[model samples]
Every structure is written in structure tokens, then in C-alpha cells.
Target: MSAVPLEAVVIGASAGAMEALSALLPALPQNFRLPVFVVVHLPPDRKSLFAEIFQAKCRVPVREAEDKEPIRAGTVYFAPPNYHLLIETGRSIALSSDEPVLYSRPAIDVLFESAADAYGPALAGIILSGANEDGARGLKAVAAAGGVTMIQRPDEAQAPDMPLAALAACPQAHILPVAGIAAFLQAL
Candidate 1:
């Protein structure tokens, strides 16, 4: 941790998102205080079952993010399919139907970058397994804003491209296995 009290967490994952998130989200204790915002690449035409799926496994409340909703502590908010999830300056959720980034609507970069702007040093950004380089710049933005940045170890990822790109963009990020990342979040 950067000695700055973290107010929120932003996590981006793809390819093996379900497995990676399963290992991480379920580990947060029921009393975990920070609100976690997650973006997992999903087909634009399909409905996202992420909130329901993770709700059963996680101790915290899990729900699909709603536009203009106030952020709540200990909640896990998953970006809705086909929309770009953004963190507003007022700490509220904003959904956009804007053109996709890196070929994904709910791009990891979109969420991470917006959250970095909203929380700055009080943010923690995490990049996990994916097939594309969507999160590299976002992780760099978080680091530049003095926020904590973490990436799953490339060797442990189902698809290493995302992690590798992030590492190349922001070498200062903590590189850890899924289990190690889980433990770090639990200690926060």
C-alpha cells in the first residue's frame, strides 16, 4: 500500500475472468470496507450474470452497477454489458453507450482510468488475466495518480498478454499470483 488510505478498488479482467475473480472476490471478508468496481469483458449482446454468480460466492453484496447510483461500501459492482462503466467525480456510477475501447464495451481501461481520476491516491487498481492489452494504459494512469497498482503474474495467467502488457507499461506494479493478490486485498 502507498500509505494512502484506499477508498475504492477497480479490477479489470478477461479471458479467465471468472476463475481469477473467484479466487479474489470471495476472499474479501464480510466486513471489508472498500467498494470494489469490476470490469470483465462480456459480449455486448448478452446479459451479464456476473453479479448473480459472484453474489453466491462472495461475502459482500454484489450487483450490476446502475447509472447515477451512489457508491456503497463493501459492495461489488460489476459493469453492465454493452455499457462503459465510469466513476463520476461525485463518486457515483455513470454508464455510457460510447464506442468500445480495444474492441470491448466494458473495457478495463475505461473503468480503471475513470476510477483513477475520481479517487487518485485513494484508489487501488488491479489488472488480471486477459487476451488483449486493454488494461496497460489504465494501470499506468493509476500509478501516475499515485494509486496502488497490481497485476496477476503473467506466468500464472490463463492468457498472459494482458498482464505482460501492463507490466511493460507500468513496471512498478506488484506482480503476484491470484492467491497472493487475494491475500493482499483481504489485508487492506
Candidate 2:
């Protein structure tokens, strides 16, 4: 099968996210050319060092996503602790204090749904290890938009609820272990 050219990638993770992200981020080649957007559940009342931690370990630049910021290829943008991250029609980012989805403020569904709408067939969405079912509908949205969808193999996930839920919601999503995910993305 032919591979679709991707403009961007979006990832969602929660419980056990740190270890999973550490394994996945370093696998991206230094020159890999796509903007990566990520949302990981964090307490709304606390500050998060998610970007800083990943930036220190990842080959690509990683930073907190800012409103109206133009997404550049090869950079990683993390949704801040208390806001919902959305994509604007102009290809910029917008953060909202909208009510949480699935009990998380920086909901994966919020980011994935908006991104799928903005990027359509050129987007790729990934649902990683998490304790909740938050990313299920969002992965379905990505697939419905003709974007590629990937789910961490349930057996390989530290907390499989998120991946299993995604597969149930979008059965066609490619199921891969963390290592396979890294390789598949590098191949893209």
C-alpha cells in the first residue's frame, strides 16, 4: 500500500505516559519532518514540566504550545496543563479553558478532533497508553477524516484501556507496540 504524506501528527497519553513517551520520542530521527502535537493528562491545579522533560530527552525541539503559534515541522508541541489545545483554520494553535472531556482538561479528544478537522487526510493520530477511554472517539474522528490512525498494542501498553477503547471505536487503526510505532513513523 502507498503511504500518505502527513503534514502533522497528534499523540495522546496518560497514566504511565512518561515511560511510554520516553521510549517513543527518542526514536524519531533528528531530521524527521512533521509537527507533533501531544496531550498528556495532568492535574489542572498543578504546573507541568512535560515539555521540558521531553525536550531534554528528544532529538527535536519540544515546547508548550502557544495560542496563534504557527506549527513548524520537526517541532513537538505539548498542550499546557490546564487548557484544551485546538487548531485554528489558519494552521495556528488556540488554547481553551473549555470544560474538560473524560475528566481531563487537556483532553486528547479535543486535540485530535480539532487537528483532524484542520489537517484532514494529511494528519496522523496516535493513541498511547492511558488509564481512561478518552482518545477513542478522537481516533475515530481521525480515521473518518481520512487521516491515518495508530493505537498502541493493548498487550504492550502499560495501561491498555485507552488503546483498547480506541480499537473498539476504530477497529481499522494500526495496532503496534511502542517500538513498532517508532519504526512505522520513521518509515513515513
C-alpha lDDT (0 to 100) for residue 70 of candidate 2 = 87
Superposed Cα RMSD, model 2: 1.1
lDDT of 2 by residue, 72-92 (tens): 889999999999999876799
Where does candidate 1 clash, by residue pair?
none
Candidate 1 deviant stretches above 4 angstroms = none
lDDT per residue as tens, model 1, 45-145:
98899999999999999999999999999999999999999999899999999999999999988998999999999999999999999999999999999
Shift in Å, residue 77, candidate 2: 0.5
Off by over 4 Å in 2: 1-3
Lowest summed lDDT window (length 10), candidate 2: 1-10
- Candidate 1: C-alpha RMSD to true structure equals 0.6
What's each prediction's clash count? 0, 0
